[model samples]
Target: MTSFSYGEFAYVYDELMKDVPYDRWVEYAARKLQENGLSAPSILDIGCGTGEVSVRLAKAGYDVTGVDLSDDMLTVAQDKAQGEGVQLSLFQQDMSQLELPSSFDCAVIFCDSLNYLETEDQVKGTFKSVYDHLEPGGLLLFDVHSLYKVNHVFGENTFTYNEEELSYIWSCFQGEHPNSVEHDLTFFVYDERKDAYDRFDELHKQRTYSVDTYKQWLTEAGFSKVETTADFTSDSPTDKAERILFCVQK
Candidate 1:
C-alpha cells in the first residue's frame, strides 16, 4: 500500500525521526497558545502520527486523544504512551470520518499532517469533521506546506542520512501542478539479530494550499475567526518557506 504500514518500521520510527525536534514544536505551540489566551484542558490530535504530540500534550497536563489511519503507527504510539507512564487515548480512524463523541477543548493537526489528505474535497471534509468535533469555543490548529518551498527550494534535490542499521535516500521533485512536490524515497534496513536485510520504498506527495484558501475553508466550516502565521515561531510567511500554521476558533 502507498500509505504507511506498521510492518517492521513501527519500532524504529522514533529513532529514525530523532532529529525531528518534537520538543521544540511543543514548546512553540504552548507559547503561542499562552499568547492567544487559550488553555486546553483536553486535546484531540488529528492525524497524530505515533502519538508524538499527543503524549507530549498529555504530559503537559491535558487529556489527549490521538487518531491516525495507520494501525502500526497507533500501536507504536500506544506503547510509547504506556512506557512513558502517561495516559493518551489513541484510535485508528479516517480523518474524513471521525467517530468520537467527546468534544475537545482544543484540537490540532500538526507536522504537516494536513498535507496527507490527497484531494481538495478530502481536505475540506477533514476541516468539516474537525469543526464538528470542537467545543463551541474550541480551537483547531493546523499547518500546511507553502508554495514558495515547493517551487523554489525542493524542486529536484537529493539528501541522504545513514544510521548503524538502516539508511534512507530522499529525492524531491516538483509536481506538474503549481504548488506541489513529490518525494521519492527509498529505505534500506538491516536486522543485525537476524543477519538479514530488507528494503522498502515510499512515494510521498505533498501539495500546498494558499493561505487565503485555507482561511476561507475554515470559515465555511463555521470557524468564526481565523488567524495565521508563516511558521511555528508565530511569524508571517515569507517568500523563502512553505510552512504556515492556521489557528481557527469555532
Candidate 2:
C-alpha cells in the first residue's frame, strides 16, 4: 500500500471540495449557539483542514483559531485566509492531545474529522482536551460518519472522478475493526507544459463507533449536555443516516 501524505493533495483540496456546503456549517454553529442562549465571539476549530469553514466563520465576524495535524494543509489555509483579508490564528497540533494558550466560548470538530481516531481512547482524550480548553458552560460541536455509512456505503466500493485538469480513482476496503475502512486513492494531474499527466497516490484510514459510545465518552469528558442530530438537520438520526452531528456543552 502507498503511504499516506497530504503534501500534494493539500494543494487541490479546495478545488476538489468546492461544492461542499460550508456556509451551512457556519450557520449551524450560529444557530446552535443561539439555541443555547450563548454568545460566541471566539471559537476553537479542531482538525481544521484547509480552513474553509474556519475562514468562513472569521468572515462572519468571529475570532477563530484553527488546529490541524498537517502543516501542508495549514499552509493552504493560511494562504486562503490572507487572500480573503481575514486574520486566522492557526496551529499544528494533534486533536487527540490538543493544547492551546487560551479558552473560548465554543469549539468545533466538524467534517467528520473524528473518524480519523482509530481507537476509543484517542477520541476520549480529544474530548477531554477540548473540555479542558473550553470556558465554563462553553459549547462543543462535531460530526462523524454514521455506522451505516462505514459498514455499507463505503464497504469495498470503488469510485472515480474525472475532470479537465485532474482525475482520480478511489477504492475503499474494510479495515481490521468494525466500522472502519481504508481508502486507497490514485490521482492524475494534468501538466500543461509537458502535455502529460503526473500521477500520485495516498492511503488513509478511518474508524467510527456507535452513537452510544460517543455519548458515553462525552459525558466522561465532563460535558454537561449532549444532543445529536442527523445529516445537518435538527432531528434524531435514523438507522440509515450517513452522518451524525453532536452538540455538547461543557
Q: Which candidate is the best by lDDT?
A: 2
Q: For residues 137-193, could you state the per-residue lDDT of candidate 1 as single tens digits?
A: 888887788877777778899989797788888899987566888988777778688
Runs with alpha carbons beyond 4 Å of true place in candidate 2: 1-4
Candidate 1 local Cα displacement, residue 72, angstroms:
0.4
Judged by whole-model lDDT over C-alpha atoms, candidate 1 comes out at 0.80
Which window of 10 residues has the lowest lDDT sum in candidate 1? 1-10
lDDT for each candidate structure:
0.80, 0.91
Residue 219, candidate 2: C-alpha displacement in angstroms:
0.7
Model 1 deviation from native, Cα RMSD in Å: 2.2
Give per-residue lDDT, candidate 2, residue 19. 84
lDDT of predicted model 2? 0.91
